[model samples]
Target: MKEIVIIGAGYGGLRTVELLSGNKSFDITLIDKNPYHYMQTEAYGYIAGRFDMSDIAIDLQGLIHGLGPNVTFIRDEAVQIDETAKVIILKEQRLSFDIAVIAVGAKTNFFSFIEGAREHTNGVKNMQRVFEFRQAFEHRLYAKLQNSQNSLNRAGDLHIAIAGAGLSGVEIAAEMAFTLQRYHKIHSEKSQRLEFSLIDAADTILPGMDPYIIKKTEERLHELGIKIYTKAFIEKIQERSITFKDGTILPFDFIIYTAGVKGADLIHTLDTPKNRQDQIIPDETLRLQGSKDIFCIGDCTEIKDAKKVLLPPTAQVAEKSAAYVARSITRLSEEKSLEPFHANVDGVFVALGGKYALGILFKKIRVKGYFAYLLKKLISRSYRFGLEIKVNAGYKKRHVGSHDTLCR
Candidate 1:
């Protein structure tokens, strides 16, 4: 069997594994730093205590255990890849592969160059960091409620300042506000705790999204009790406050930095063509332009084609790219010509607090409320069902994803 090693169990990496799970001719090993797959897009809900860990994480071992004898799962971090020798070196051992796919996604840009931001704010990149913020926020809120030390009208109430009102920041703020309101309801008479604020340097939130959608989202967020501050840039992150570029100081108990992103520094560790933003340059085939047998997918790659503009680092693009690559790989193995990847910019979906959501559907129509939530749940269930069947019966097993049935 041919050996194929795939790095990073993110949207793209895991999708590739699901696509090629049953291939008997290839021994597949998927490597990830974490043991379980995280639903990062929905991670804000987890931070807000709206969803539990089980709700956001899938059993990676269970998915592979169901695969039985075919695929192997190695829970390890990949440190380096030697393309010439087709070898991957982890912390302990180096493994060789016939074909390798590098889809390790981008990290929180940190923009550590900016003074004082690193030590003060929590980033939304990995699961551990997000969980840490959750713990911090909860701890402060609980302490405030228990305090005989502070007066009821004192200035020590729980204040959460989020420094980026982009998609993640705004959504997280809305979720946190709603969760805080729920907590406040139970302890209403004694203490008034929990204030949420969203700060963005942009003129408005969701800069890349439709203006009308942005307006609607902004209004809905306000209705949910989240304060939004636009056209404000952070000059420095202080111990208990955020100093704006305009010299205004806002104090808070917790700060979440979801501001900006750049390609991972690891991509620059090698000699590769990079765009102005430093994202790896990839050809239409999704292969690194100047590197042989090296493919780049997801947010780490710079997409320069006119047909498909550089997409936001979202899961949708990663999932689509992974499928395209898996099919292309199979085609190449059979001595067939490969197809170029042309991504269709589908509509964006933003989940509001509770069952409410707003986004363009099919890039033509607008959808919100219960119908959108139902669609989101249906998508998740369909994905889970398809992956489950793929593992149970291998690639030879025929499966259909139909709404009436579970696996459509």
Candidate 2:
């Protein structure tokens, strides 16, 4: 049997396994830095006390354990991939494979435009930071405010500055606004102070969103008592104060950075075509531009077409890429013709506070409220079930033979 190794057990990597698992022709190994696959969409809800941790996290082991003897799941980081040697080097061992799939995702990009910004801000890259920020918001910041001796002290106000105005930034600001207001209301009854500010570089929040949706989101955030600062750029980010372009300084108790994302730094080491953002440049077939045995997908790759550019960073794009990859790989292994990987965006969904959401469906149909929320949940469930089916099918076919052979 030939060996196949996949990196990063996020949507793309895991889906590839689901498609190829249980094939006796190839041995599969899935590697990731973390043990659990985190659902990025619901992470803010978990942080805002609206949802539990388990809702956004699933054990990678549990998913693969059901895949039986055909697939092996390892908890390790891919330090480097040597295309020449056809091997992957981990911290503890090296994996030699006939084909390798790279799907290591991107990380939050601070841009380093503002000095001390990276150090001073709370990031929403993973689940831990979200909870950590929430903990600080609730316990530390509130405690500092409540115990202040001077009523005129700046600490009592507890200003929060969110650095970016993109989708993640907007969503976080809205959630924080709503949650903090509820927190303040409960605490103020017993006499405690709280305040917040959401700042963005653009003149308005949600830079590219439709005017109606943007206005609605802004209104809702304002209703929660969160101040919005438009057309503001941070010149300096200090430990306690953020200085803007016009020399205005604002003191902040917490700063959340949701500005942008860059491809994983590790991908820079690979001898593949890379974009300015350091994302792998893949051909129409989703294979690394020059390499036949190697494939690249997800946020780590840039998808190009004849007339227009495309973004391959979202979970939706990653999931679709994985499906395309599965079919392509199967055809290649079976010595069949290959097809070009074309991206068809089904929809785009952004969640606001609580059950509120704003979305543009396939036909540009705008959606919000309970129906959009329910659709989001169903999409998540479908993803989980799809993964489960692939693993289970592989295990069922290999279990008895492997068990009986081991006993003999």
For residue 194, model 2's alpha carbon misses the true position, in angstroms, by 3.8
Report the C-alpha lDDT of model 2 over 160-198, residue by residue, as the tens digit. 788887777777777766776676666443344556677
Q: Estimate each model's TM-score.
A: 0.90, 0.87
State model 1's lDDT: 0.75
lDDT of 1 by residue, 281-335 (tens): 7877888775545677777776533455667777888888888888877776677
Off by over 4 Å in 2: 141-155, 189-193, 210-212, 304-307, 384-408
lDDT (0-100) at residue 137 of candidate 1?
A: 71
Worst lDDT 10-window in candidate 2: 399-408
